[model samples]
Target: MTSDQYIIQRKVNIVELGATLGNISDACRKLGVSRQHYYDIKQALIEDGIEGLLEKSRRSPRIGNRVAPEIEQRVLDYALEFPTHGQTRVANELKRKGVILSAGGIRSIWLRHSIEKKSLRLKRLERWAAENTNVLTEAQVQALETAKEEKEAHGEIETHHPGFLLGQDTYYVGYIKGVGKIYQQTGIDTFSNVGFAKLYNDKTALTAADFLNDKVLPFFDGFGLSLLRTLTDRGTEYCGKPENHPYQLFMHLNDIEHTKTKVRHPQTNGCTEKLNQTIQEEFYAVSFRKTLYTSLEQLQTDLDAFMDRYNRERTNQGRHCRGRTPMETFIDGIELYQKLVHKGELMH
Candidate 1:
């Protein structure tokens, strides 16, 4: 029962026992309720019978609110027409029809008698496990065997030095309440947990080009690196003929050596992909508690603050600079970069 119901039940029981004992104070002290409350319950019971002393139902007395049957059917029909439209949009549509209802009220009515889709996107393993009795196909078995043998020979991740590799990928930042869906293009340096994100309207070549030119170039330039090997997914944004692709042009301009992950294989860029989860949990989830930004400029400002906190304050898990933040590690890396540059050493 709800707390309200529980309190009323306790008060009613106290009054009943107090009447039997012929002392209100004795029952009030034992029950830890005021004598006024005990007497109130006794008077309620005497006037309206025992039914009045019992807890009343919290469910609204009104039937399905004041919304007419015809209006509710119209809301359902509109929802059916556009499956992607959420409760807020449905409420707005209903308001245009001269029917006023709060979003929560509309959602309650919509959910009461409708089939709803789950919000989460199912992973491949979950889908495969549900469909097949034996989860792994023969092709998957062969690929796993090959990967295991290679890993056994090569050992684990090379966490020894800097400038070894850099990984890149795009992650969707789910649907924002006011702004539509957007992708967060991200990059992670292998040696350090230092990463950056640039929001994109879509996963197009032009947007991908902006990430390469505006975000990636300035970072590499700050560290005085020109020719580093970059890992990326073979999506249309990053691959295709150089003549037709913008990422090709940008990479060439910046003298960046490029490598692509195998088709249908995400594990190749697993480090950066895992970093995407960190971005979502640490930045997006935390920022929602404060103001939610609608414009791109405000969103970028919030992202910059989040990135600063992530790199300067947060600690890495298993790498060498365990206690130090990514920013501190990055500073240490800069010292190494300057020393190399001074010693007349070629660096990538």
Candidate 2:
């Protein structure tokens, strides 16, 4: 029977019982229904008959406590940009951008999208980067080829040439007694795994732009290669209004394209993230235990030495590295890059 029919019959049974027993209170007590409820059912039966006794369902969409469409879209965009961020972080980040959303509201939205976990967010980033490869550099086309295999199993990203895609990220190197907090701006060429790093006391839009201007772009320019695109996370240091933000403005002036990882999905820029881990494990872990540093310059001098060995001396087992030094891989790849240029695949 329909729910309405079942409810109507029950109401009828209660009214009939009251009449048969000749005591409304006795009928209600036996049925385990309250007297007031029985009276309400009787009044409904008298007024609108059986139809009035049936309960109505609230089938329409709820109005109150619902998030606005624009706000919802912003939340989803933020999720894609910073997939690793928790609800509190997302809310705080949005607030800085003039979007007011509570952590609970952000969590509710995340629950709906099924990206509440970091892994799901990273998966969404992988899917997004795969589907929207056009936004990525042309040199990154081979990454789509990597999709045939298990990406995580293969480890680092695959690139076409030296300037194909540069993975950039910020690393916190812990606080020194006199230096306060030391942040390292790190970059790596995905094709050759050639790495570059510069130390900074603070991480900001200016510092991010400066890393490229001083260390990254200069190295590529010295080799007469075009730095096509850079990949990073959606941090304020790397992203903002083109005219107002130093990093964005620098990119615009330099004619370099920018791409970013989904929020909390650092592996989208895996080359740099891997380098960060390596630097921490191989260099910082060893160096910190051996030396007591009081100045940024003192520590930086030692870090530069390590970076030199990493690029030119330390052997690597990267897919493109093939058990050669990063500098060797970078040098050998130049010929392959030039041949592609001759084939008209790359600009002359």
Model 2 residue 30 lDDT?
A: 98
Query: Over the full model, what C-alpha lDDT does candidate 2 score relative to the true structure?
Result: 0.79
Weakest 10 consecutive residues, lDDT, candidate 1?
147-156
Residues 1-348 of candidate 2: C-alpha lDDT, one tens digit per residue: 987788889889999999999999999999999999999998998889877888856786566777998998999988775565668767766875789989999998889789888667756765676576424332223222221221231245547999988999888777655567788999999989999999999999999999999999989989989898888889899988887999999988988889888776666787787788677645664455345567889888999998997898666768888667789999999999889888989731
TM per candidate: 0.51, 0.55
Supply the TM-score for candidate 2. 0.55
| Candidate 1 lDDT over residue span 1-348, tens digit each | 977678667766897788888888998888888888877787887888766776668785567455788877776665443333456655655665577877786676656655343121112222333465444344333322232111111112443234546677877765554565667888877667677788876887777778767876677677766436678888888888997688888777767777887786767777787677666544553343234457656777888787776677655653655656666776677667567668867345
Error of 2 at 78 (Å): 46
Once superposed on the true structure, which residue ranges of model 2 sit more than 4 Å away at CA?
1-158
RMSD (CA, Å), candidate 1 to true, equals 16.1
